[model samples]
Target: MLEIGLTMKKLKLKESTCAICLTAMKAGQGHAIFTAECSHSFHFHCITSNVKHGNQICPVCRAKWKEIPFQNPASDISHGRQRINAVGWPRDDTWMTVLRRLPPARLDTNRHIPSLYHAQEPPIFDDDETLDQQHVIAERDVSIIDGVGDPNSVGTIEIKTYPEVSAVSRSASHDNFTVLIHLQAPVTSGRHSGSSNNAELPQMSQNSRASVDLVTVLDVSGSMAGTKLALLKRAMGFVIQNLGPSDRLSVIAFSSTARRLFPLRRMTEAGRQEALQAVNSLISNGGTNIAEGLRKSAKVIVDRKWKNSVASIILLSDGQDTYTVTSPNGTHPRADYKSLLPISIHQNRGTGCQIPVHSFGFGTDHDAASMHSISEISGGTFSFIEAEGVIQDAFAQCIGGLLSVVVQELQVKVECVHRNLHIGSIKAGSYRTSITGNARMGTVDVGDLYAEEERDFLVTINIPVDRSIDQMPLLKVGCVYREPITKDAVTLEGASQVWIQRPEIIGAQVVSMEVDRQRSRIHAAEAMAEARVAAENGDLARAVSVLESCYKSLSETASAQTGDRLCVALCAELKEMQERMANRQVYETSGRAYVLSGLSSHSWQRATARGDSTDSTSLVQAYQTPSMVDMVTRSQTMLLGNPSSHRKLRQALSFPAARPQPR
Candidate 1:
């Protein structure tokens, strides 16, 4: 056994060249290498590029790859050793004899092999590299809003309007058109705008930013007994550590019932220690009572005496709700869980301020539908933690956005200015919308705006043809919100009108790529919603079909506008969604939750830390806050008290690389 192990180690050391790159794979080199199940090693970028281009087979062996390799090749050898130990050596065979008898594996070098460096495919590598550079530039742009004018200025949110086309046909009796409203919050130097390498919490002074009042509602049910509960604790610790002294935190645990483990208090050093202690005391038992948990969390938020603070709730659960009522006959489960959505009612009883309730489905068994609905109703994003250990990354992403909020109680209004123009409809994802003033004006209640966060609203307008006017203004858009620093109301309406030229010829009207991208996103989100409903109803085939149709539609758009990053990303997402839906095992285990949460994220225009899909153009990768990306990259090393063996296993399984850039 020792001789065989030594021989294998020597062989691994000797195999220094990557099959795809045909270059030395050495430590401390710039590029990372991945080993496939067939033991064929290639550069990580090379394999990823191959997979992204719709090739799922190994480059050298043509073997179908089940999953992308994201770990160090050394781990495979370690796993091999473990398997060898599990199936103990034959008693009759000696280790030296077996080592001598084993023959060296042969590589069929005569076979033609495709290389990324091939002359015919030289553009592929360059295009991928360009895409990666574009992603970095996009992230930098998102991190720093340059045209804000004043660096010290706070509470500045910019809004831009884009029309589908610049011209409308005068021959038609009525012209229907789409308009997009894009809103962005300014980034300030006082806040953490870019990514960080260390997982340590940032230090803040007293007057840096708005104080956050965060309530964590956790599920401590029997289903979350062992590993789930432990990860939750570690995640909570990371959360607590991230908050500053100006922030206030409250902890609530639920199973058959709910109780507050810690009251809302400023996170001073002492307060943080107490919160950590409370988290450590959690024990899993009883059935899941998600409603009770939310109810308690709402009560805590309502009872808080603090004023002028940024407040929200983070609810995490691992199972379906066991909501029941006691009657004279017997205890009975509730007929519907929708009636238990208490977020709106609690908001009314409080200061009338909107409180976002970000909910996370911990594992596969959790009710994703209920969680998504809960978040949508409360103007929050729903995240699906399909894997056990990634709960920390999800929580970190949610909290990172929360802590960087720049504006509150944001409201956007679109009013038809022309007499002939009328509002058809507005699509603003999960945000609440209302039509007022005889359907001429539409209002969207966008609860909060994070620094550097972008949101889009698509509005359809009905225009009556009029040859008398060469150009006409159709709609007037405006924004009203409260600045977090001064708690003062600010209204913006500059350059918010949409106008179209009434051309007699009606020649080819130029389309706005930005507007078209957003339109495709809204359509894709609707399709995802349909697929999610079908899957939940046990019609996997119908769900798969719906996603396939959507993918086809988006793919056409993507192919036409390959330069549009958002459009291409949406197409990739739809393709991934359809592939997951087509597989029965994947859909049931993690796909259902993934699809539901992804739909919610899309509809709500929020980013999540769900799957580790290495697609660089993915919305999650593009929109994720820098702090979120950093924390997710370093989650495995964030030690919370766990058995060394368990930690080692987690470290081995955890992919240390950040989501790969395009290259």
Candidate 2:
């Protein structure tokens, strides 16, 4: 047995108060004083209560608490008394060095001192400076200059438009072509310096990441016994460790019912420990109530009022929801599943911001269709974890993007400026698009964007033949978003505009490789969707044939372009799908879920780490190490352009290397 002792003395002060309870402490009263090593004083009862709750650090300064001492004023007074000499108490002029070395103080009445609280006026510019400021600006310039641009500007979300053919041949009939719109969020520097009025602004992160309010809904069903539950615990531990102090977290566990193990709290040292304790306490038993889990998770978010933070939910499950009633044949999930969706996903009624719920189907037994639908309805992505030990990597990839969000409420709009131009169709995967004005205007709701994240939309335009006009306005593209740090709405317009040339002799038209690649991706997604439908209908042979045809087409495209990494990767995915569809047993077990999850990822334009892939390890490393941006980009190499194009993009963006911090 070990015993410890506390050494203490009576604290003497004119009027001292306890820091913990903020109550006055009087000598001879019943209150005891406890002092930590950092010299912060607190009431004995309050300090003891804090310690009982497993807080090993000082609440005031967040310093590690050493062995504290307890002091009693009455006992100290009885123990000893010290005497003071009075010989020099009234005559201590010898120590006054200031009076001997300096003259009397004087105030200068002519000097005008400005008020600290008053706002300063803008500086007047000379003619030369005005001329310099009036220089022509480039079409692609988006930098914010002090005193020259909007003072409230945080940064600009870049929008680039690429058409299949820059110049179309003039003909008597209307010509239709495809246009690709790419939107990328600005790279944050993690530090902002400006006027003193904005000094107290909240920073997203020291490493250029936005703060997040993440709620993790975990399944502790009977199907997750042994290895599955153990792996989940480990993956959750990794998640807890990676979150910064600015981020907030909540944990919900569900078996037959749902329970809030950890309430929404900042990811401080104590909070992380409490979250880990909650994760470790999870036990695998009872039926899976996924609806209850999602309901509880969304309630947690809806109850809390979060500001300037990215709010999201992450749900992990390994089995079907037990709340659904069986059909006549009992071979499929009944229509009752639809009733649980609205209850699972909750949107803020006041702000109208939809909280996305990213769902993870943990095993083959999980309901893939329901999981994918949950994510789709909530504007989130679905990931499939078909193998053990890969859950951590999947979670890391998801959380990594969440932590790096730089823009919110992103909206992209495209309009036909010419009277004859018309918008035909917009292909933006799973994103929602609205068209109005007789197909002359189209808008896509892009939601939030991560740092350096790229999203592309392909639009078909109907161009009318004009023989008289030399140049005609084609289309206008613009975007608007809320900056994460400042929460200011930034609108950018006229960034890209297309014009048609009507020359009698037309030059040879060059097709953009980027546009072609995106076209192929869209087609591939359609093929995958068709294959999934066939597989779901139990036509295994048809699914295999569809996959093989898509794979052959992608192979030919990849062969034509020597350095087309995305085409090659898509080919590989289709080939894998073919092999799995050919095997009836695999198709029934994990292949169906994998196909659905892949389709979800492609549609959402979010890359996920599939089972036991090399990219999974790279994604985990990206989350753990300092080269997050580089490593994450490499992990999603299939979405990147060719080597030269990628290099040019990096140079243009000029992302700074992140400094390493201790985990």
Candidate 3:
């Protein structure tokens, strides 16, 4: 039977002495639970107060507890405690032995804990002070200042971690973890345990298998004038040239509007060159309209009837929407990028097409809030191109990240396997699975599998594979995308092959969840910031309206995924933040007031048409806003005195007549 722990084992506490009582736990009688990678364990309850959200790490070792996976029992022979907490097969003797030993709760608490795992070496600690005490003091002293709401804050989203084949499982037990297994493998020459008997296990195939479909959407907007636009073009060129035969590509460009430069096409040499030509033709004009742009690109995939491929849309934009078209009833504005939902798109699934949209933020002004929402809704990736020159590399990385589905409806049947291991949620592109049934040592079908161009399984199992018993249980995995006979409807079938080994825990779920949480929180903060900006410009109604919408989105997202306490906190924090911004009166020097006042008074003339009285007169009515006029004069004053202020002032200037028409 598979055995899961009854309680969460606490990592060793960091303080040399307890903060409250100033004494360590009683010796032998109290257990000090150490994390798997580091020789640090807390006195069960010492670190709870410091937890901000989710799992906390050992203060001294910096070893996070959640990354450690559950291990087997036989390996824990030396640990006198009846309960065995097996880490992965010993990489080193010291690692195995040290983890196997139980620390004297009282004395070991005061001693320096060495890094005993081969994977992570002990950290150098020169100071004599207890690390935990110092850490607590430092953390507490850190001012709980308001989070930054700068433009960069709105557009920066980072992928904190990438998925790896082998990693720790992060599932809490469902009905407690326990398991039993019985395998039926063809007998071969191998030692059966320690007895003088032979055990034969089924020899399974081990061939590398993979397929991917990637769609790229780019922003060709006026704001991307210099380095930003050039970098993006170079990046697209690199992606198209290096695409493998097994991969497929589609290209779309958005200016003030969205256009499909190249429809979803195979990555053939000619097709790649044609797509490259399309990419080369892209130029900056017009404004940003990411919502409509994404909608149109997604439509291309639907029109072409592409399905079951590792579908993804990569969007690169540097600003917010200028104009948008929505439903006639105004229930859902097509132009509203922030609240665009998958269900809205799915309902209008004009054709049978489903593709994930991954987004990449280019500059500091890129609308990360909108891009992040699109990515999360589509169950795709999102990242930022931090430096200026690395655009091509960024695009290449996006292309390489797509998943390729080989087998359609894959289902694995393990004949005899039982464990208390709780199966976490499974994600396979469009195909997903949920764990069900009794925890018994018998047959079980997990889910379907997908393949990439170069075949690899993106799988995550709760337990390690080495814990196999009874000649390694047969793993039958298969898929059914379409009926062979009818060739119309989706169907399923048994796999002709068996997985010789356990699927690795790629940790894609955890990564996706974590990234989503961080991005959403940042997005909520940004929307609030933008609303405040509008408020500062004397647009109180717009500020109130936008903040209300942002609050709702944040609240709903946090509710959908219960673990995100930060988003929930931020949601409440935003209302307070916005109120403060609203309370601050917009002075005459504010950019909007200054600009508006000059335009109304006809004090500022259009540089391009200084003598065109007719044009100047017409523009004054549209451009004049008391607030904007005041701000522009102040900005001009600053620009005249300071070179640095020129760029900032330039950003505030707008010439409607000089703007080019959208292509």
Tell me, by lDDT, which candidate is best. Answer: 1
Which pairs clash in model 1? none
**Model 2 C-alpha lDDT per residue in residues 504-579, reported as the tens digit of each score:** 6677776776677777777788999999899889998898888888877776663236646566667767776776
* lDDT (10s digit) by residue, model 1, range 37-106: 5455655544543443344444433333445422222333333333121112111101112212233233
Tens digit per residue, CA lDDT, model 3, 1-663: 323222334344434332211234343545443333333333333333223112233333222233322233343336543421131111111111111222321223433433222223113211111122332332233223222531111111110111221133322211211121111111111111222211121111111112345667888889986556645654665566445444567677788877666445554444554555566556689988887788766665554543323455788876666566546785533344535544433312212244556566664556544555465455444454434433444454344333212222223322213233333333222222334554221122212122111111222334434533322222233332421111223332333222222333323432233334434544554565566468657777787678678777777763325745555545544454444344434321122222122221121111110111112111121112222232223222221112222222212223121211111
Identify the leading candidate in terms of TM-score. 1
Q: Kindly provide the TM-score of model 1 when superposed on the true structure, using C-alpha atoms.
A: 0.70
Q: Which stretches of candidate 1 lie over 4 Å from their true place?
A: 1-152, 171-174, 192-206, 323-335, 341-351, 558-560, 583-585, 612-619, 630-663
Q: What is the model-wide C-alpha lDDT for candidate 2?
A: 0.62
- What overall lDDT goes with each candidate model? 0.63, 0.62, 0.38
Per-candidate TM vs. native? Answer: 0.70, 0.69, 0.35
